[model samples]
Target chain A: MTLLSVSNLTKSFGGIVANDSVSFDLNEGDIYAVIGPNGAGKTTLFNLISGVLRPTSGSVQYAGRDITGLAQADIAALGVVRTYQLVQLFRQRTVEENVQIGFHLATRGGVGAALFRPGWVRRQERMVREKSRELLRLVGLESQAGLVADKLPYGQQRLLKIARAMAAGPKLLMLDEPAAGLDTQETSVLGDVIQRINDQGITIVLIEHDMNLVMRMATRITVLDFGKKIAEGTPVEVKVNPAVLAAYLGEAELE
Target chain B: MTLRSTISAKPQVWATALAIAVAVALLAYVFGRGGYVVTVMGFAVIYGVFVTGLNLFMGYAGQASFGQNAFAALGGYGTAVLCADYGLEPIVALVLSATLSAVIALIVGYPTLRLRGHYLAMATFALGLITYELSIEQSGLTRGFMGFSGIPPLGLGRFQLLSERAQLAVFILIMLLGVWVARRLRGSRFGRALLAIGESEPAANALGIQVFRYKLVAFVIAAVYASVAGSMFAHFVGYISPEVFGLSMVTLSFTMLYVGGIGTLWGPIAGAVLVSFLPQLLRGFRDMQDIIYCLALIVILIFVPKGLASLWSLAVRRSDVPAER
Candidate 1:
């Protein structure tokens, strides 16, 4: 079943088109990769889907519901969560605390529970803490849970950001350049973790520059060039397509 | 005893002890002092409540506001108008005044909280000016420039708090309540959300926090605090004037927030006492007092950018843990 569908999605900043006429369907429990060269509107596509940026035109349907222009928080509450290409952890708070913040929307109580701190709120807070610890353990940062997020190593910060997003219990997790600055070993570890997370029944949509990682893990791939979709197929099919090759290697290189 | 186990096992006993000690000292001062000292202490206690409210908006929420004094003025004038014109009790006047200030905050915050950074600051500053002008020009309601007087003092049955000692007791009670509220907010989810928003608005919003709604709530809560402080100030001083809640008063509150440390709950209390009593401490220097005050502030701002809380925390760290250990 399709978990998310985008139809004729278009976004522009002033006169520049960032995402133009983009359409795709994401199936349930599938690991989908979005690949493009620099300035191909990959991040813009993620932002549009996550509700961080409103579309200039077109529609987005998640779980058979249209959610084109919802606010980021509302979208997040509806189980669509995205991570930044640049890690954005709460620097002053501990790793555990940062993860717990992501659990804020998932807590049992609404505003009343938050304000009043009833018995249920305390229980919910305890549950959140336990879940946060579990997420930390999953991402191999359990030992560093008490450490301030800013104090963690750059590679660990990336893992922590993924763990933080997972704390929200998202149905669809969109990672923007999850392995951007990692070393070879760190990238391998990240690839393994992403695979494990996907195996746990969470649909994954990722934008990655690492072609090896994309080809090895992605069930399907959507290729983009200069704000338009160039190709959509299985990783093997996309790797062999001449248009996809030209988009990646450029027309002169193809010639 | 592994390093992690040792560090994690130790309770925050020192912070608890220090808080208790300070509470005791405040209690001793309230009961021991007489005349002017008690009066000054009363002012400090009320101002402490006022500054803590400002701290919630500026420090935790990361929205600078210069209009807290306007809220304070509304509270003071609300109390005076209610008590003098309507013959209501001071207690009733206090509640009504706080409600009035909160209503005004809602009106102002709805449009103003949408603005970012300096635009928000400038908009709130204009609000402060408008409130001051309205208080002065409203003539029959606010009594114009002549100022309002005869705000009946607070009382419980036959025992009215007319003396400095009695007023000090009431002020202490109010300050304790303020401290309790601040501490509660510090531990609450709403407080954490505010801190998150303060750190990064877009990140917090993406994490499912209603950023604008939280900001508006913080703004109104802070206004309510200022109003309560204003009502207490009017009753304590036995007068209410538009000038009491002017730009200088707003600056004084901002200085308290800065000098104390922005995010900490106890910082404003330490700041209010220092700024309130600095003039008396420099009374001997008469002609040079203003110069000395400005210099002290500049030096503190330069050396202790995080304010006295950072220094105090450093001192506590040194005393609690051995230098080599």
Candidate 2:
């Protein structure tokens, strides 16, 4: 079942086409990866689908709903959540508090309820706290719960972002360079954590430069070169695709 | 050196604020009734409510709004017009005026909040000026620069808060209530979203938090708070005028918010009390008063940039294990 479908999506910044008529489909319960060299518009494609940028032309159908031109939060509420290429934590809050922010939409209360502290709000808060801890444990940051978010090491911060994003209870998680600044050790753990997330029935699409992680995790792969889809298939098929190889010519990581 | 950024309010700070609340209520009676000191404390509490609202917007939600006085003017004049001119109940005037402020905030915040930093500040500043001008220009309704008097004292049914003693109790109660409400909003889901927006808009957006909607709601909430403060000021002093809710209020409240702790829970009230009382303490200096005030603020800005609550953290640092700032 297709959870997300991008057809003829194109975005241009003046004369430069950041994303030029890209097309792809993300199926439910599958780990999909989009890979390309620098300036291949991989991040641009993520932005267009996640509602950060409006496409010049083309439509995004998420669960058969045409979500083109919708606001980023609206798209997220519809279950498509993304992370930044550069980590964006609350910076001042505790690690646990950062994840609690993710559970925002799942819980319901207004300004009045916050002050009133009704019975239900208390119960909901306790439940979210427990759930937040469970997520931290999932990402192995449970002990760091009391520490400020920014005080965490860079690798842990990246993992913290995943935990924070997971708090939103997303059906589809789009990760932008989830392994951008991590060591090989951190990257391996990240791959395992993501697979565990995928195993639990959430669909994922990640833009990554790490070919080994991609080749290991992606059940299906989409390759883009200069804002257009150059090749896409199962990992084994795309590894042998000549166009994908040509696009990665001097910058070869397609081995 | 590391004690500067005290973002979260611990239970200890709240206990201290409550103690101050009790003391402030007693303060009105300590100097005796009908004295000038109670009037000063009364005004401080009123500004407490106003700055509480401002803190919610600027401190928590991480949005800048310079025009909250617009709503205060709305609340003040709304109460004056309804009570003094039309013979409405004071309580009804307060509620209706706050509602009116909310509507105005919705319309104004929509356009003004789109800008960030200096631009947003300039837009809100203009909004405040426009409201001030309206208060003066709409002579028939607002009574113009001549001002409006004979506004009824705050009361319900037949019990008027006539005495300075009675008014002080009422003011303290209202200020504490305002603090409770702000605390509730800050500690819960609503507040977390605001803090997130304050830190990073894009991150909050990606998490399904509506950044624009949250900002507008915060602005409206802050405006309602300003309106209540405005009405309280009008009724407490028994007069309403354009100058009371002018740009100077913007300056005064910002001072109070920073001195107390911009984002800390007790900061607004703490700042309000200290900044309000400091002026009277320096009254002996006469001509040097403003100079002393400027130096004091500079000292605070240089040493405790996060506000007085940051000092509270410093005070408690010895007894407790230091956590990540």
Q: After superposition, how far is residue A26 of candidate 2 from its true place, in Å?
A: 4.6
Model 1 ranges off by over 4 Å? A7-21, A53-59, A68-71, A108-115, B1-11, B315-325
lDDT of 2 by residue, B1-325 (tens): 1122253445557746865686667574545655777888888899999999998899988888888999999999999989888888888999999999999899988987888889998999999999999999999899899999988888887778888768777888888888888888888999999999999988887778888989999999999999999999888989988999988899999999888888877777878978888888799999999999889988988887878777665554442222221
lDDT of 2 by residue, A1-255 (tens): 999999999999999998888888989998999999999999989888888889999999999999999988788888888888864899888788899999997889978778788899999999988999999999999887877787899889999999998888889999999988789999999999999999889999999999999999999999998888999999999999889888988546644
DockQ of each: 0.40, 0.50
Q: Over the stretch B23-112, how does candidate 1's per-residue lDDT look in tens digits?
A: 688668656867677777878888999988888888888998988888999889988898878978888888999998889899989999
CAPRI band for model 1: acceptable
How many clashes show up per model?
0, 1
- Candidate 2 CAPRI level: medium
Question: What residue pairs are clashing in model 2?
Answer: B260-B271
Clashing pairs in 1: none
